[model samples]
Target: MRVAVYYPWVYLRSGIERALIEIKRRSRHEIRIYTNHFDPRGTFPELDGMGVTELSRVSVERTYSAVTAAALSIVRTRLDPAEHDAVLVCCDGLGPLLTFANRRKPVVNLCFTPLRATYDEVYRDRLLARGGPARPVKRAAETVFRLVDRMAWRNFDEVICIADTVRRRVADNRLFPESKIHLAYPGVEPRLAVPEGASEPMFLLPGRIMWTKNIELAIDGFRRFLRDAPPALQRFRLHIAGMVDAKSRPYFAQLQELAGGDERIVFETVVSDERMRALYTQAWAVLAPAFNEDFGLTPVEAMAHGRPVLACNRGGLRETVLDGVTGLLVEPEPAAFAAGLRRIAQDADLARQLGAQGPARAAAFTWPRFVQTIDAVLDGAQRRSV
Candidate 1:
């Protein structure tokens, strides 16, 4: 089969690249990616090591322009009546897919979420209240998305959601055949062996310190957890590793102020992947309290390290974190999160058991499995066209 995968955003770019690489290596299919956005400055070439072929490189000085160009190209090419075995669009925001609704090729859309609901439920207010043209722009953008989403869903041959929660939401929308919708989780690299002496009570939370991450809640929980923790456990530390952009400066300042007079909370921004991996290895668990993550990669990385993850029970977190088995999932409330933290702190054996289960569970989500899952869908699409 010949597969063309379109990725409009840089973030989703890596995941598509990984799956393509796996398909190229293991599946008897020719896979190529088409993109007008080249982040030569970014680490996108990192996927080259994994073996995905880049069919075309489109350069753009700005993010939005690149996305628009990509979408337009999809409609022009895919709708030209020139058929392909399969066409995979990485996310719902790609508008060009709607234009190609009646194309002869099989269209597989990776539906991460309904864009309008994503803004209304997760990001709009918090971002809007922050005061910027960004908020209103998002509002207008979401309105446009509602129309795009409906067309993309009805037009595509199949819609793939990353989690069951997202699938259920789309199912309720009832725009397409239920049989055409599929659940396809993100793939992660295989787990590494747990490092010796990894049972120490350190916590790793990596991701940008943005409002969506709910970093405020994590900080509050950690501070309160320390307040009543036993003397020995007081030494336990949290190392937050990630970038702190100018937009997040105010929130970052508040986090720093909250940790005042407490030396256990360490904030390191723009850390390297190796440094981030080291933090994951040394920690007893990874803390990801994000409120509206579509699908988080941090907790998966933690699982890859054979470390347990403590995340809020919402969005993709619930799908990723196996409560009582892989890691503890708590509500968004600080007290609830703090209690879970304390529970693991006091029960070393239980923490260890959960920690040990993580790597094995992480094993089932390798790049190979992700590629295979996608290949099966593409093959089925090809057969039906016959």
Candidate 2:
């Protein structure tokens, strides 16, 4: 099958890229990716040879760039199943909006979610609350985007949500029947190498420094954990590492203030991949306190490296981290998170037990499985069209 893929951005590493790479390698399909921008050096260089076309006409900026591009992309490009047998949208946002090119072809959307700006109530409210006249203006703009997104989604032949949480969201729309939606849980590359010796009890939380990440809650829980921890655990450190931007600086500052000169609470704004693996190897467990992540990759990465993950018992985390087995899941509340942290700090044997199971659990989620799931959806979509 000849597949035309549409990914909205080529900025960062995520589960989408991992899945796409496997799709290209394993699927018996010719592929071409359409997008507004793609930097081979910045993203994976392998994408350059994958027939990615950057629509220079679609300008990418900080805000409204993706929604704008999505609308423009469908208007500019013309697609036919004769030219391309399937349309694969491997994007979280905007790409679903490109289904306007469906034209009776099988449109299989690798939907992580609808455009988050339009669909995510919390993200929309937080992002638009600037004050007075500007707030209303932002709200109006988002409303238009949401309308466009809902309209475009109607054209999708199939929507594959990467998690059950996302699948449920699509089901709630009822705009499309549940039959068109599916769960294609993303998988990870396995790398199990348990550390040689017991390192200090360190908790690693990694993601973009955004309010959406709920980094503050992680910090709050870490502070609480430190207060009552034993002398040995007192030396334990909480490492917060990820990319940061100007808009996120204020939140980073608030986290620093929350720390209150606690030397054990370390903030690493950026780290090389080598450093990240090193941290994961030596850390006690990956801390994922994101309030309700659609699907988090940090915990998976931690587990792939044979370390346990302590995450909130919400969203996709619950699906991956089996409570009291592979990892412990706690409520989003700081007290609950702190208690979970404290449990691990005090119980070294429990930590080791969880860590020991991490690799095998992560192994079950393989790239082959991810690709096969997606291929099955594509086959179904094609068969339905016939």
TM-score of each: 0.81, 0.87
Question: What TM-score does prediction 2 earn?
Answer: 0.87
Q: Which lDDT tens digits does candidate 1 get at residues 4-57? A: 666543432233444444555666677565554434334334554543333234
| Residue 84 lDDT (model 2) | 80
Model 2 lowest lDDT segment of ten: 190-199
Instruction: Name the best candidate (by lDDT).
Output: 2
lDDT of 2 by residue, 328-352 (tens): 9998899998999998878889988
Task: Give residue 179's lDDT in candidate 2 (0 to 100).
Answer: 70
Error of 1 at 136 (Å): 6.9
- Stretches of candidate 1 off by over 4 Å are 11-27, 48-84, 95-104, 116-120, 124-141, 191-197, 243-262, 271-273
Which residue pairs in candidate 2 collide? none
Relative to the true structure, how large is the alpha-carbon lDDT of every model? 0.68, 0.74
